[model samples]
Target: MSYSTLSSRTVLVTGATSGIGQETARQLAERGATVLLHGRTAEEARAAADRLIATTDVEPRQLHTYSADFAHLDKVETLARQVAAEHPHLDVLVNNAGIAAPERHTVTADGNEVAFQVNFLAHYLLTCLLEPALTSDPGGRVVNVSSALHRTGSIQWSDPNRTRRYTRVAAYAQSQLALTVFAADQRVTAVSVHPGVCDTALLPLYAHKGISPAEGAANVVRLCDPAVEIVNGAYYDRATRVEPAQAATEDRTVKRLNKLADLLVSRSAA
Candidate 1:
């Protein structure tokens, strides 16, 4: 089922040039909802938007593009301001861009771990900057793309920055957990989806896990569809019945997680 009944809603999708993101943009456009396509490069973002317009009834002006490498929080901030200034009444934000690299302990420009900043912090800052627009409607949706990796992950309160220690899979898992908790803490209706192991290049983060990108994208799109609007703060997979996340369900736990993120961002800014 289509998520928006507004006939003309604006949706922004990150990492939209490839994989699940590309597919979600296509599906959303086909449903007649405007979609803002996001990618790392300008050419790629524009091309992806153009392709969707060609194949779907999406109005040409309805499809927009924003480019930024998630490796830098400055870029995410810039993108948020640019988007908000351009489209003042954004109705949805799919914080879906993610990357996993096993070869090193990557860091963003702010010196935060790469996976933590790109996969998690970038979304956090983006949502915070756009809070006015989201809360304006109260019914606005924020669909966060977390993962099932948290089943094996735990919050490392002592070292979330991975300043002293880091493992590729562990850091990736930790970031997903952090993102889910953050979503649950926000005022607007927010939910996280763990697109099960899919054949996306994202799996190479584990150096072996694999599943088709289509299968991976299924859940992300499901969470965005209007049918699940009442599923605020829930975790979902595909179109299955919604489920509560352990962290989201636990008040004290989510509070702590938010506190940690707050401290990290404060220090990072300092």
Candidate 2:
């Protein structure tokens, strides 16, 4: 299903200050898409955008910077509002912001496990808030940069935070699983991709060495193209579509996760 070139599209990529997110923004901007670069702080966001212009042929007009600490839900809400207000017709949302679960179990001020909030919940809230802009156009969609490790996760319904039994790996996996399942949501056209084990800060979780962030970002940028038709809820390992963990595609699990996320995000906002 061929559509249009990115030259006419506007995309917002979270976590663009570094790693895959930064590379994704760079690639998209190079292809003529208006890329919004989000970072943990305003200074970081501006710095990433500056570095892109300095090192690449990308023009300053092609980039915009935004910042919000995902550790806080209110900040996520604010970020969404600013983007939606500034760009009414967002063509793509790359939910690429994430962090490895710290060795010591840590909870955000929002009351969610740090990794879970930063990796999944914040994206969930941002996506929901941006629904209007996403659906304003016919081809708009979401690309979730999930992980293969999601297969190792299970949602602890009784205690989502795993406050009783916290392990860094488990906590991180659960967040990725929730993100993968979220693609099944009927509210929007969305897909998740495990962009291979990239040599980013999170690489230690997968291997001693991995591919470059630009290589992984290519897989993500491909999905953003309207020409590369996608099935809603599809999961991809790099550029090949594949089944996600069984639970990720289950309708019951999707609904359950939505409920859990709604509660978690609303509670934090309240």
Candidate 3:
């Protein structure tokens, strides 16, 4: 991809402090796009932004820091409002902040499962809240940090919270699977990517797996390529090629997922 040609766009990347998110920010910055880095805390967000400025060709004015702990629904709302208020014309938003759970269950202040809260639900709510700013951009894009593990998952709407049956790994898979379906349902020029087991801190949560963060993020940079935007909603693996599975093609499932995600969004907003 020609980095110089993409310089005119602006991007907001969540979880920019580490792993694929961090490398994505770096690659985008190198390509001359203004990158707004999001971190769980203020200090980390600032540091991530600084790292981009210090190392890439990104303009200083284009680099920004947004700090929000996604586990808190209110914080996600606040972060959304802040972005729209400050940068009313957003070009792309990447929901990349995620956590893995290999054992046990945890709840957020809002009482939802932790992995689903940050992984699928928070991004869903935030994007819906920012629709105006997003769609306002001529050809906007939203990237959800999904996983290949989604192929082995199921969404029990009656027990979306996993209050009845839960396993740490399955919960994570469910979150990613839900996000993939959400992307299809919203038709919001979004796509879910596995990033193919990047070797990042998230690895320890699952006993360390996959390649390096840079390789895991190669698809992210490709998603930004003009060609990828032309074919939105297509799943891309590490090679930046679309490789959606059987479930990704089911309209009935997509409809069901849309209804489920809508219900969850309304409940959270209420």
Candidate 4:
């Protein structure tokens, strides 16, 4: 893809302190897009922004930082407002912030599973809140960083939080699956991508070999490319289009998950 297409465009990438998110931010910045780098805290975000400026030759104004704890739904809302308040428009929003807690089950302050909240709900809320800004641009895009594990997973509607039966891989897979379903159901232009089992920190405990973060990020950047015509609500494996699991294709489950997500966010705000 050419950098000229991204020039003057504004892009936001979550979990950009390191790994795939960081590389995506760098590449976008290098292409002359105004990149918003998000992290869990202000300090982390600032550090990431500074690193981007130091490493890349882009102007300081071309790279910005925003902080929000995705585990906390309220904070996600706050982050969305802040982005809207600061930027006049957003051309791309990359939901790359996700977690893979393979050790044990942990719930956030909102009483939702950490992986579920971080991997799916947080991005869902953020995207909804930013819909106005996203829709303002004719070529706007929302790229969700999902995983191939979603193919092997199913949503546990009875216990979406996994409170009764918690397992690391199960929760992680379910979260990815939910994200794919959510992307498929959105009215806005959105797509979910599997970053090819990269060597990111979110990888499973037993796995050691995979593609580099830059390689994984290339796939995401390709989806974000404005020059290419993308099929809205499509699922991709790297640059290739692939069918998601059966659950993701079902309109009923998508509606159900969307309603559940709305309830979760509303209850948290209440």
Which stretches in model 3 have alpha-carbon errors above 4 Å? 136-138, 204-209, 227-229, 240-243, 267-270
Clash number by candidate, in order? 5, 0, 0, 0
How high is each candidate's TM-score?
A: 0.88, 0.96, 0.90, 0.95
Give candidate 2's TM-score: 0.96
Q: Write the per-residue lDDT of candidate 3 for residues 1-270, one digit (tens) a residue.
A: 445456777788999998899998888877777788999999999988787778766677777889999889889889999999988877788888898954777877887888888988889888888878875455588877788888877877788788888998789888888877766755478877778877787785445566888877777777765544545677777656565666766788887776676676565322
Per-residue accuracy of model 1 over 202-251 as CA lDDT, tens digit each: 86654476666766776776666665554667777655545545765788
Among all windows of 10 consecutive residues in model 4, the one with the lowest summed lDDT is 261-270
Clashing residue pairs in candidate 3, if any?
none
Per-model lDDT: 0.76, 0.93, 0.78, 0.87
Which 10 consecutive residues of model 3 have the lowest summed lDDT?
261-270
Candidates 3 and 4: which is better by lDDT?
Answer: 4
Q: Write candidate 2's Cα lDDT for 1-270 as tens digits.
A: 222458998999999999999999998988889999999999999999999999999989999999999999999999999999999889999999999999998999989999999999999999999999995466689999999999999999989988999999999999999999999999989999999899999999999999999999999999999778789999999989999999998999998899899999983422
- What does candidate 4's lDDT look like per residue over 103-196, in tens digits? 6779899888899999999998999888888844666889999999998777888788888898888888889998898888656799899989
Off by over 4 Å in 1: 1-6, 135-139, 205-211, 242-245, 267-270
Deviation in Å, model 2, residue 17 alpha carbon = 0.9
Tell me which of candidates 3 and 4 scores higher on TM-score.
4
